[model samples]
Target: MFASGASRRCFLLIVFLLCAIMSRSGVQGGANLCSVDFEVFGNVQGVCFRMYTEDQAKKLGVSGWVKNTRQGTVVGQVQGPTDKVREMKVWLSKVGSPSSRIDRAVFSNERDIPKLEMRGFGTRY
Candidate 1:
């Protein structure tokens, strides 16, 4: 039977909280997938940066592709579990190949994805 208004509101509130928790914990379908595009500045090119990026992505269990841009920068897109994607971002922004110098990193098109766009990490050139 339908309860009083207060009781009904409480039940709805509990359901809402449960849904929020599930989504946050990635219990819901595809809630934990994230996608981001990044460009690394500084001496990123000709330093095996793309190779290192692919390696890092694979290590982190993410799927993406990295390539050298004509502007003397490294560009890529990464998609995977939210936490792993975050780690990859940090690696691109701060740490790169042994000989690479990272002056700045720019990220764009960041969004939550329903699924990964790629199967495995790879170099695009």
Candidate 2:
């Protein structure tokens, strides 16, 4: 129908305007990308902490790298959607490897990244 063409055009225009508004409002389609660096202290080394962290990060669809520090702690950086990053931080702080005793997790250098700096989660060294 001729009316159908006009209505379709109007709908597309509306959709375009909505997308513009959303982008201008700081929406990145899915969510804002966030990155954070964390160091977990207390009984983290030699406990498969980095392995567990890698698994959890992959499961949460995040990308980052984890490693053991010379000071017997676990250090890592996580980058993903804001909510996913928050969840990862909680897991690092509270629900670390079953064999690991997490005294506390210190997060630093947290910022909103326009894009992810890493691809895929893994253990470093």
Candidate whose TM-score is highest: 2
lDDT of 2 by residue, 1-125 (tens): 43798898998999999888887665756558999999999999888888899999999999999998788888989999888999999999999998999999999999999888889998888
How well does each candidate superpose onto the true structure, as a TM-score? 0.77, 0.80
TM-score of 2: 0.80
lDDT of each: 0.90, 0.91
Itemize residue pairs with steric clashes in candidate 1: none
lDDT of 1 by residue, 1-125 (tens): 55699998988999999999998887888478989999999999888888888888889989989999899998889998889889998999989999999999999999998777779989987
Best by lDDT: 2
Whole-model lDDT for model 2 versus the true structure? Answer: 0.91
Model 1 quality (TM-score):
0.77
Considering summed lDDT, which 10 consecutive residues are worst modelled in model 2? 22-31
Q: What is the lDDT of candidate 1?
A: 0.90
Model 1: residues with Cα > 4 Å off, grouped in runs:
1-28
